[model samples]
Target: MPDRVRPMRTVPRLGTYNGFGRTLLGRTKPDADGACFATHWFTLLLLPIRPLGRYYVKEGATVERSTGPGASTSTTEYVFLGEAELRASEVIRTYLFRWVVVPLVVAGPVTVFGLNSDAYSREHPLLFLLLLLGIPIGGIIVLAVALGLREKFLSSARVPEWVGSGPPRG
Candidate 1:
């Protein structure tokens, strides 16, 4: 009698490496809206995190030694959510903090910097310096805040639960 061997089968693996990858590659199941909202915003803010995690996580199966001869252990792994979720949450929180809180923190300094130039025109060259720096600093702060707000709104509007659900449960 001749020995026979079974053919091996392999499955293709896919993952995103950047923010866009998560938005594009993350599969939206009928009930996976929460995951999608998480994914979409994450993609906008931290595009690199999700896809990188996907790419780095093991997506294949391989054989290893088992207890007995002619026996092997093969393990197959799917994408990991630990790093992915953490990164996504951080991205969201960062945007939220940048947009919602940073302006208030910087506003007082900016206002005082601007006012210094009015009363001490002759006596304080440093006031002019502060005013000069303050304007640009305020502009940068505004830009950062704007970008954060835009990204947050865009991501937030894409809540998966609203758009992705299949149908009402009866």
Candidate 2:
């Protein structure tokens, strides 16, 4: 039998995140072989030791369209591992709280104490540099802890029903 040419469908745009990012949802119609595919795209933040950047992660799923003629369709669901479904705002808040606020909370007191002691400041000039470096280190630690908690929460929780709903089509 000749291969069937499936028409390409337009994916739905779920949410707008500042002009820098967007979320895409899509599902391909079943082919001659009775196989269907679903896909999703979302922006992700990549924090490095120095410069930070953002990128998109594409996730997808595939399954047999149906067991037999007029039979119920079965799908193989895909879930993001070690990550929770978070809104753009939550993601931003998470990074800020973990990478900025937590570090400042720790660094503020140490900075104050160091500046108050003349002897310490004079004898330990390197401490200032160390404090500067500690901010990033503290932020890294906070990121790790936050990710761990998110993983735990996601693992124990159920995937939202909306996530399984293939992208809206016009």
Candidate 3:
């Protein structure tokens, strides 16, 4: 009779599978707008130096390793700095990235296109107002989005808050 051999198995570190670094850059995850943070900043600061389209770079796995019950794998994701410093300027960059860029995307082009259209048209006057209003409105929207994104993604974890706003009685 011939002898049979069993395949080797491995166990991944606890919580490692749930980590952002691993899943974010893994093959199973699709390449999406994970570049939102980097894209946001470029659209603001650097885009003015060059052009809007040249801001964000491609997103993909930079490092990969397998470690599973049999063959699990992980990857390290990276964002192109695009002339922007990630550590030294994270706070300001994060602010600009989240707020200004995202909203301007919709408002800026619309206002520009609307205002440049035939001035003789009746809608031209309305578009002029729209062009003016769009600036501040876009700014506010960007601020809100930036604040929200920061709270959601940038905020660090801490101990849970106490219930009822104070100490609990035994």
lDDT leader: 2
Instruction: For each candidate in the order shown, give its overall lDDT on alpha carbons.
Output: 0.40, 0.42, 0.38
* Model 1, span 1-170: residue lDDT tens: 11111121232233334323343233222122222212223244432333322111223354455858876544434432212222444455655554555555566566666675576656787777777677667767786777666655544322211122332233
* Model 1 vs. true fold: TM: 0.26
Model 3: which residue pairs collide?
A: 67-72, 68-72, 99-142
Evaluate residue 128 in candidate 2 and report its C-alpha lDDT on the 0 to 100 scale. 62
What is the C-alpha lDDT profile of model 3 across 106-168, one tens digit per residue? 566666666666663455677666766676677667667866676667653222222233322
TM-score of each: 0.26, 0.34, 0.27
Best by TM-score, which number?
2
List ranges where model 2 is wrong by over 4 Å.
Answer: 1-119, 153-155, 162-170
Candidate 2 structure quality by residue, lDDT tens digits, 61-124: 7465666788654343332221123245435544575467665766765677666777765777
RMSD for each model, in Å, please? 17.7, 16.6, 20.7
Error of 2 at 53 (Å): 21
lDDT of 1: 0.40
Determine the C-alpha RMSD for candidate 2 after optimal superposition of all C-alphas.
16.6
